[model samples]
Target: MKSKLFDYVERDNLVFHLSGVTKLICFICLTFSVMFSYDIRVILSVMILSLIFFKVSGLEWKQIKLMVIYVIVFLLINFVLTFIFSPQYGVEIYGTKHEIYRFNSRYTITLEQLLYQITKLTKYASVVPLGLIFLLTTNPSELAASMNRIGLNYKAAYALSLTLRYFPDLIRNYQDISLAQQSRGLDLSKKEKLGVRIKNIMNICVPLIFSTLDRIELISNAMDLRGFGKHKKRTWYASKRLKRQDYIAILIAVFVLVGSICISVFINRSRFYNPFI
Candidate 1:
C-alpha cells in the first residue's frame, strides 16, 4: 500500500539523514525565527530556506497538497476574522494610515493593514513547509530518542513518539473507515450538499473512535506485558550520535534565529517593521 499523508519517507538526503535531534532543534529555531519576527524579509528568508529543505527532502507535492489546502483555508478564515474584528490594528501598530478602500466608518482597508495582514499571513505560511519536511522525514522512534537525549523523561518522549506514530495510523484508519462506509451506500461525494457531506462524514467517527480506543487498549496491554516504564532508564534502538552535518545544520538554524532577532532589534528597531516611516 502507498504511504499515507504525513508518513515518514525514507530517503538518503541531507534533511532525512540529519539526526532527529538536529531536525527538532532546527525546526524550533527556524519556526521561532519566523514566528517572532515581523519583518517580511526575515519571514521570506526562512520560508525560502524551508522550501529548499522541502525540495531536498524529496517530498512530493501530492503528499502535502491536502494539508496545504487545509492550512490555506484556515489562514484565510483567520485573516478575515482578524480584519473584521480589528480593522485599524495595523494603523495602530505603524502609527500611520494610508487608506486603500473604505467599506464603512469602522471597516476600512489601509495600506498599513494590508501590509500587516500580508506579513502575518506570510509569517504563518512560512512555517508549513518546514513543519511538513520535519514530519515527513523524521522517524518517530528517532524523534523520541532525541527528545530523551535532551533531558525529557523517557516515558513522555515515548508517549510523544506514540502520538506522532498514531496520527498517520489514525488518518489511515479514518480513510479505511470512510471508504468502507462509502462502499456501504453512504453518499460523501460532491453531489451531496456540503451539509449532507459533512453529516455523512461524521458518521464514520463513531467507528473510528471505537477502533482507536481498542488500539489504545492493545498498546497499553502490550506495554504492560513488556514492563515498559519499570526501569529508570531505557536504551533506544534509534539513538544516534550527532554528526558534523547535524551540528552544522543546528548552527545554521541558530544563526538564522539570532540574525533575525538582531535585525529586528538593531535594524528594524522594533518587532514591527514600520515601512510607512
Candidate 2:
C-alpha cells in the first residue's frame, strides 16, 4: 500500500494537537524574535528552546540533517562574502575592533567581525527548527484552512496547500525516474567522478520537468472538472477549532515577541547586544 502524504503528522506529539493557525502564528512570532534581536543570550535561548520543542514534537535530527547542512553551507558562504565585500562591517556596528589576524591592510580579521558573523549564523540557526516543525508537522489541508480562517483568500490558501502536497509527489517521481535511468546503465554513483555524476543528474531534469508538467495539467483538469472555484467559500474537512492549549501556545509566542522587543528597547538600547561593553 502507498503511504499517505501527511502520515507523518498522525503521530502523537506535544505540538501536533495545536490548531494550524496557532502554529503558524507561533512560528511567525518566533522567527521575528530571532530576526530583530542580536543579544547572544536571546539568540541562544531561542535556539535551545526551539531544539527542545523539536524533540517534543517527535521530530528527529536525522530526518532534517541534509536540509540543515545545506542551510549551514549557505550561511557560511554568505559570511565569507560579507567579509570579502565589507570586512569592517562588524567594527562599524559594534564601535570596537580587536584585531585577530592581519592578512593584509584591508583584509585583517577582527573579533568584532567574527562575532558579528556568529550572531548572523545564530539567528539563522534559531529559526530553522521552527521552520522544519511548521513544515513537517502541519497537515497541508489544515494549513490551508488555517490560512483561510485567518483572512487569506481561499484561492491563495488552497494554492499554497496544493504546492506543499505536490512536493512529495515530485520527490517520488524523481526517485522513480532515477531508478529507471540507472537501470538503463546511466551511473549516478560515487564510483564515477563528481563532475560526471553532476552531468548525469542534469540529464534527469528533462524527464522530471515534463512529468511534473503532465501531473500539474492532470490536477488542474481534475480541479476544473470538479468546479473547484465555483464557490466563494469552502470548508475544510481537516480543519479544527482552537483549544485551550492552542491559545496557550499563541500566548507563549506573543511573549517571545514582546520579550524580544523589550530586550532591544530597554536592555540593549539598540537592536544589537554589545558584548564589547
Candidate 3:
C-alpha cells in the first residue's frame, strides 16, 4: 500500500518490531521529560536522539518535510512573539542581562533572552520526531490494542484507532473532490491570485464535510449492526505480548525521564539552567 502522511510502514527494524505499548510508553516519557525541563543540554540531547531514531526507522525526509516546514514557521513566529512580549523574561529568570543590541530600553535583545528562546525552540523541536515516530511506526489497530492493554476503555480505544486511520481517507477524499472541482473549472492553481485560490479551496470544504458526515453515518450504522461496543471487553487481532526489546526500550525511557527530573531538581536546582550565574 502507498504510504500516506503519517502512515505506518512495516519494516524489520527494532523500532518497528517493538510492541505499540512500548512505543506509547517511551513517547510519553520522553515528551514529558522535554516539556518539564528548560535545560538546553537535556532538550538538545533528546532532539538528537530522536533524530537518530527517526533515521533508523527508515523514514524518508520527504514524508515529513511539509510538517517540519510548518513547525519551523510556527516556532519562528513564537520566537518573535516571545521577544516582543517579554524581552526581559530571561533576565527575570536568570537575574542578569548582557545586552546584545538595543532597539530601545524596552525592546533590547540580550544573550540570556536569545539562549532562552533557543532552548524553548529545541524543547518543542524534540517532540516532533518522537510524535512522528509513534504515529508512523505503530499500526492504528495495534495502538488501540496497546491503549486498551493499558486500561483505557475499549470503546474509546477503538474510536481513537478509527480516528487515526481516517486521516489517509480524508486526504484521498480531498484529492478526489478537489480534482472534481478543478475539472469543473474551479481553478486552485497558480493561475489564480492567492485570495482567489483560497476562496476556491473553501468551496471544496462543503462537499468534503458532507462526504465525511456520510462516512461517519455509514460506519455508525455498520457498528450498530455488528453490535460493536456492546461488550465490556474485546480482543485485538494486532495485539502482541511484549518482548525483551520492549522491556529494554521502556527501561531506557524511564532512565531518561528520571535523569531529566534529577538534573532539573537536584543539579540545576531549577528547571531553567542559568549560565549567567
Candidate 4:
C-alpha cells in the first residue's frame, strides 16, 4: 500500500521531463504573488492560471478530489467566520456602508463587509491551487533532492523526505488496523454514533502510536548502525545532475521573480498593499 501511494506521486513517465526545483520555484513565485496583493481580479487570474498549469502537468482529477473538497471547506469556513465577525469590513476597504441587518450594539450586516469577505476568499482561493500543485507534483525524494541542491544538509533533507515518504504508509497502517479491529468485533463505522466512534478511534490510537514508536526506534537503530550522521557529506540516491532544462527552468524562475517585483511596484508602488484598494 505504501509503495502504491509513492508510485502514484513518483510516476516515472511524468517526472522524467520536469525538474523538482522548477516546480518548487514556480510554486513559491505563484504563492508569493498571491500573497502580495488583495485585488480580487489578480487573485482570480492567478487561480485560473494555476488550474491550467495543473491540467498541463497531467494530474488526474480523481487524485485531487480530496484537495478540491478541502479548498471548498476552507473557503466556506473563512467566509462564514469573516461575515459573522466583521459584517462591516467593507467600510474599511471601500469607505461605504450598505447595511443589511443591525444588531444590538456592535454588530451589523453590510454589503461592503460581504464583498470584502468575498475578496478575501478570492485571495485564499488563488494560493490554494498553487499549494495543491506543489503537493501533488512533488515526490518526497525529489523534494529532498531539491532541498539538498539549495544547500541544506543531506541528512536533514533525507529526514524530511522520509517523513513525507512514510505519511501514506502511516495512514494505510491506521486504516488496516481499524479494519482488523472491526473484523474482531469493534464497530468503528460512523453509524456507531459520534461519541462511540470517537471512543473507538481513541482505542485504535493507542496501538497505532505504539506501532509508530516501534517503527521509529527500529529506524533509529538501523541508522545508528549504518553511521548515518558520522560523516559530513552523505550521498543522495535521488539527486539529478543539473541539465539544460534545469538551467532554463532557473532562468525562467528568476525572470518571474523579477517581473513580479516590478509589476508589484507598478501596481502598488510597494510590496505590502494593493494600491487599487
Q: TM-score winner among the candidates?
A: 3
TM-score, each model? 0.94, 0.93, 0.97, 0.83
For model 2, what is the alpha-carbon lDDT of residue 112?
91
Question: What is each predicted model's overall lDDT from 0 to 1?
Answer: 0.91, 0.87, 0.91, 0.71
* CA error at residue 12 for candidate 3, angstroms: 1.9
- Candidate 1 lDDT, 1-277, residue by residue in tens: 4436877768888888999899999999999999889999899999999988888899887678789899999899989998999899999999999998998999999999998999999998999998898888999999999999999999999998999889889988998998899899999889989999889988999999999999999999999999999999999999889999999999999999999999999999999888889
User: Please, what are the lDDT tens digits per residue for candidate 2 over residues 1-277?
Assistant: 2323323446687788888999999999999999989887888998998888888888766557668879989988998998999898899999998998998989989999988888988898889989988988898899999999999999999999999888777777777888889999999989999999999998898899999999889999999999998999998899989999999999988998899999999989999988898
* Poorly placed runs, candidate 2 (over 4 Å): 1-7, 193-195
Candidate 3 — which pairs collide?
Answer: none
Model 2, TM vs. native: 0.93
| Residues 232-264 of candidate 3: C-alpha lDDT, one tens digit per residue | 999899998999999999999999999999999
Return the lDDT, model 3, position 179.
88
Model 3 lDDT-worst window of ten: 1-10
Winner on lDDT between 1 and 4 is: 1
Residue range 129-166, candidate 4, lDDT tens digits: 67666766777787788888888897888898888767
Instruction: For residue 258, give model 2's deviation from the true position in Å.
Output: 0.6
C-alpha lDDT of residue 137 in model 4: 71
Off by over 4 Å in 1: 1-3, 192-199
Alpha-carbon deviation at 9 in model 2, angstroms: 3.9
